[model samples]
Target: MGKKRLKHRSLFLLGGQPGSGKTSLRSAIAEETQGNVIVIDNDTFKQQHPNFDELVKLYEKDVVKHITPYSNRMTEALINRLSDQGYNLVIEGTGRTTDVPIQTATMLQSKGYETKMYVMAVPKIESYLGTIERYETMYADDPMTARATSKQAHDIVVKNLPTNLETLHKTGLFSDIRLYDRKGTKLYSSIETPAISPKPTLERELNRKVLGKEIQPTLQRIEGKMVQNQHQGTPEFQAIHQKLESLQLPPPPSSNTPKIPGL
Candidate 1:
């Protein structure tokens, strides 16, 4: 396959406490900047993982990862699309964001677009609790929200396991398998589903370094809260709101347009 040329956008990252009303601020900023903006949140695309609440009812349910929309693919796609369009961005997500921000900064900087962070420094325990609260409310309204929340929370669990084990015994390929070696110590791997056996030598090594799942989600929740605009009625907020209102979107192209004659 041939390599495709990538386009970039200047994103203004807005991360803080979960349920901090980041969406409200995003709306305000979009209105203010008069530049196109959209969230990379769960609503960006549809996710399929039915019955997460039922699954969570089982033992060991951690909830943040279950609902977050900032998956690896979605993140990369948003960055690439933004780069191409060169539009102003106001991203909203939980705190423990991965290399996307740094990578995006370096990339846009090279292209002459500036980037800034609005980090919310707060307590981790408080942040984690906030995420749970947001999802509980979100799931009540959106089915997709429920599934994403379950997936994110499971991600937290997989990241919080021991790394020193030389070997992991597997009675089955996925979660149904028994994971302890004869020593009786439990093993941890990303294969929550029965897709792959955790007993593979290389796979075991990869899973070990990932222990520490709770940290990022906790950070995200706090980040979400701090960045919220409680007073959208403020002058600055209203300015942005008005600018957004002034934008004139183009109509969709007509279906009668002719296609190329040759393939």
Candidate 2:
């Protein structure tokens, strides 16, 4: 008789904006799988920091340069370690860029795991509002911090969503891909449908983000409330907002473009 073969487990990559309901879906999937899945969330590591709340405030302003690198390193290390042990992983992240998730997916695929990708397909404004609402309710003691973090999340969703979808389609890394709206509705599925451009509303939202104007009214409203109470908005918040507005992002690359290297 031939030697017995070990069946490899699956890797589920759950991608979404900060408040696009990844957590809830992850929980549901975990329960459905009967605790057979291990979830690796970038924010989980951030929360492990002694100054987690404070780091959330800092992340609003300097996430890219100051916060993300540390979290990314930790996340990468954890994923590698768990994959080597042959655990089924439900890896979740913002999917702000195609690079990390693609790389992670490719690595796990090489390790004999089947990979699947799911992106939250909620509207940017709705996701932004959800962030604010979640933080306001969950962290009522720190409205200012909530506003800041929500704004940061809003920006990320606006800037990355279209490209993220396009990239996922182009890479063809996953055996299956899906898009779920905020209500857990499956709006699209690669297994059942053809590729399509992001909705026009999404494109407009991206334009607004690149122009740095989408979150201004919300910021102004929050700042107005704070100033009414004789409290001031943090200088970092103002500075980062201004910087984002002044910067210009390049056009999303064509789908026909080659997949990113090391993916």
Candidate 3:
């Protein structure tokens, strides 16, 4: 008898801003797959370091620059090894740039693997707050093991996310692409009727969240409440709160936003 092919040899690409809950969603997907998937999260590699705690304390945000290259090489090697064996794979990233992801997707597609992408559609204000809260919880539980997201890096990813998402979709390398929220709720799915495209839907939702008249007032209220809270009394959070208060989110691209070529 001839060897049978496995349809489950799939690759899932998970990308979002740093605090957009990619890790949580990855965990959920892994659980649903019952550990049948190989996860390639760069942060997972960073956290695996023996001196991760000490490094975070010593270098703070610069910790990533010092150690990420080694872990990144390891991740690349794993992708190569696992894809050869036809294992279902899940890769997580901030989608800060379109190059690596597009390249990875193209590589996997050439291997006769079905590639799928899931992007988190989270508001920047909410995601920025999420980063602070995540650090606070992790640092409180175990200072040595806690890893903090760089504010500068987080902001960069936040700024570039829309463009990155659009670029990936336009590439047409993945068979499917989905947009999800922090709570694991599916906000938009590309496989739905093609009449409803991802770009316009993503643009509208993101704009509605931050470009409205209520945004500034809402931010002020959050900042005032944060000031009253004991945990949020720290100077770091105060600076972030102020930044969010003054943040000027871009409006929907309207005429400038490109349509998804064939969509």
Candidate 4:
């Protein structure tokens, strides 16, 4: 008898701190894949906001205030909708604490998708400096705002990035995982082998810490304001909502069922 060939859709989780070159790497992968990958990038939603350019020009502070919450929600909703549609995905994000990517990969795996994770291992200080330089160059018209945003992003990346890479390596959720340097050089790839046992206790503790410390507070703040502004009827949110409505996603599953956590 011939060997059975296993086939499944792919989900690539590109993990890195801000300015660590996730977007660039994602673009490269998309091109290599011949545009077959659907990107679920955090910044894409922000860029799609109706007033994004205008807000960046006039009141930079309001840009963050309005775009942050809506972008987060839209990204998550789009991931769910697209994954359900069986599109191959390339998701880019900070992966601040590893929980987000691990949870996301697990959800896709449960849906019979194959998962790969690429963790970018850039020095925290270098990433911070790079962010300032990149943003200053990209947003030359608003250097002050660019520097402020870069600095704020730097703090979060410095605080969470070290542990994130370590935790992600430990998750075992991905069928294949690779570490890459800032220049897109692959550092290490996990060996192809049989199913590995999960360190559930460690994962649970990490999830608890991440949720209690980072995610929950941020979600609470965003959810509270989302109730108030109703997303300010942002185009990004409206488009995602329309997609979700078209998908007709069912009501929440039971507690035991795995789902993607709000990042």
Candidate 5:
């Protein structure tokens, strides 16, 4: 039998925080481009370990730290092997740091692959809630196999996201950079290649200043729900409430404030 050949080799990186639906979006991209695109997620490898459930049960919040090294090695090996074979690939990451994606994109680009990036521009508060909701739902379905995202991990990603976005943009590695909300709505995109004649290049400044206002409505709604459910009193819920409150926009600078003069 002969090795299968891909018509066009491409690398798609779908990135977001821990619970921002990267898995679903990655699956959709694979399904849409059925033949050659292969998914290389560390979580998939991590979950497949025979002792994974046991480790999760034992370590709880610390499980990811214990097992991620093994998963990362496997994921990296797989990425290298698949790339060498001329396969189209889709990988998911937290986008917490630029090192992995930037390195991967650089390697694949050198291998005659077109690299593109999709960012899930979910609100920090929504993603924080998402992690809790996902864990509870999964735990209800099957306690042994359930996974919980740690608050520290989620918060670290959220805190570094603005810098990560700017770095990725400045690198100019990806031909297509897209931002989508939790509901999969297209919030922004920078497509630079085979340009469209009519549409001018649309670039959205995706930083804390912009996202702070964007996340306001969702934050308010979630806080209201927490109160209505009487969950605001619980330790976990209270912690979440405090986090959301901290994300609230700051007061505008007063007009009466004196401005510095160049003279």
Candidate 6:
């Protein structure tokens, strides 16, 4: 039997402090990989807000909290669309502001693709505090007008703060902050890909095991009938063979493929 050839594309999420050389490294990787590395940053969608200034501050103040969830959905859609178009994605963002990376990793892992986390860092330790200070004086006069920029700054803080998030977990100023960061050197992303143990839908489990990972094990009855007629000339077999050929499944030993034991 021919081995199952799996063409797997992985997504690596580069997350870290602003001063961290994430952008430079991401750019270098993308250039080296040519079209394979796709970096999606917030700057792409942020311009869409008509009153971007107000939105930025509101985002920082935690006033428009629901926007975070919507952003995650929008990102997922963008990643999905990009994957379908054949470019492997590298999602880069200030994770402090939202749960987009967790959501994306969960979604991609479920679909059988691999996802990884990257932690980039730079030498600046107190930059975030200074950033918050700048936002305070810069937007002091206009409560409603300074939101968009505030939100952007807030995102940077949320993702890059010196305070430990897991230990701080929602203490006063931090309610919906990121879960954790700060374990070790670069590439030590706390983010983990959960086990891909799909709930037993007797049908799917059975199909996957028998059809050998690539073919629909459940469709063995159909696949067997199709392969049996791949060479023998007949319209019904020809149609079946055509359908099977398009799927490009591996040739099997028998029409009635054996079932995987556990499924």
For this target, which candidate reaches the highest TM-score against the unseen true structure? 3
Worst 10 residues of 4 by lDDT: 197-206
Q: How accurate locally, in lDDT, is each candidate?
A: 0.40, 0.62, 0.69, 0.59, 0.67, 0.43
TM-score of 1: 0.39
Model 1, 1-263: lDDT tens per residue? 12223254345555434433345445444554553554555444434335445534542234335533435556667766756656665565443334454555567666656554332322323333444446544545553434223335533422322121111112111112223221223343334534443325323432333222433444344334323524244332343333333233443444333321110
lDDT of 2 at 233: 50
Cα lDDT tens digits for candidate 6, 1-263 = 12122357666666555433355556544553554666766545543445555666666555334344555566777788776654556787644633555566667665555665444333222223223333333345444332323435534553333333232222222212211223232222232312211112211211222232333232334435334434235333344344455356655555533221221
lDDT by residue for model 2 (1-263), tens: 12122366888888777666787667546654666788887765654555656766766534434555677788888888888888888888777788877888889999998888777766565466456445544334654333335466567665777777676777778877776665666666677755654333335433333223544565455444444444435443344334333344543443333321111
Pairs clashing within candidate 3: 53-144
Number of the predicted model whose lDDT against the real structure is largest = 3
Q: Please, what's the RMSD in Å of model 6?
A: 25.4
lDDT of 5 by residue, 72-139 (tens): 89999998998888888888887888998899999998888889887777655556667766765665
List the candidate 4 regions with Cα displacement exceeding 4 Å. Answer: 1-7, 31-35, 51-59, 141-152, 192-263
Tell me the deviation in Å of residue 163 in model 5: 2.0
- Model 5 stretches with alpha carbons more than 4 Å out: 1-4, 27-35, 50-61, 142-145, 192-234, 237-263
Across residues 155-231, which tens digit of lDDT does each residue of candidate 3 receive? 78867777777777777777777887767787877677443456665555544455534344544554554454444
- How does candidate 3 score on lDDT? 0.69
TM for candidate 3 is 0.71
Off by over 4 Å in 1: 1-9, 46-71, 120-129, 142-263
Per-model TM-score versus the true fold:
0.39, 0.63, 0.71, 0.61, 0.69, 0.41
Candidate with more favorable, higher TM-score: 2 or 3: 3
